[model samples]
Target: MTMRIVAGIVISAVVGVALAVTASYALATSNAPDREVEDAITTGNLRAGVVVEYGTR
Candidate 1:
């Protein structure tokens, strides 16, 4: 019984670590825009009062 509980705790910890690593990797390699694109959007918005949604574009 104690061994089973310890094994469960170890398995849960390993899974948690794996999930955390995967999440970190996903966030690190996300599809966020670069500086030029952001600058262009900002410029357009400032020049023409346009509202550009990044996700839509």
Candidate 2:
């Protein structure tokens, strides 16, 4: 049905936007090399799970 087709298209578009945003965030964060150290020390915790895994500034 036409409604089904329209719903499918909307779903695809939403998925595409999510993927693009994630990709952009990854790219932006990829520039920093000492991200883990910086984040851990700043937050006063050495736990691997405590630091933000992203490479962003």
Q: CA lDDT of 31 in candidate 1? A: 73
TM-score of each: 0.54, 0.58
- lDDT tens digits, residues 1-57, model 2? 999999999999999999999999999889866856786689687656554445565
* Model 2 pairs in collision: 29-55, 29-56
Ten contiguous residues minimizing lDDT sum, candidate 2: 47-56
User: In candidate 1, what are the lDDT values of residues 1-57, reduced to their tens digit?
Assistant: 999999999999999999999999889868778866798898664646575567544
Residue 49, model 1, lDDT: 57
Best by TM-score: 2
Model 1 lDDT at residue 22:
99
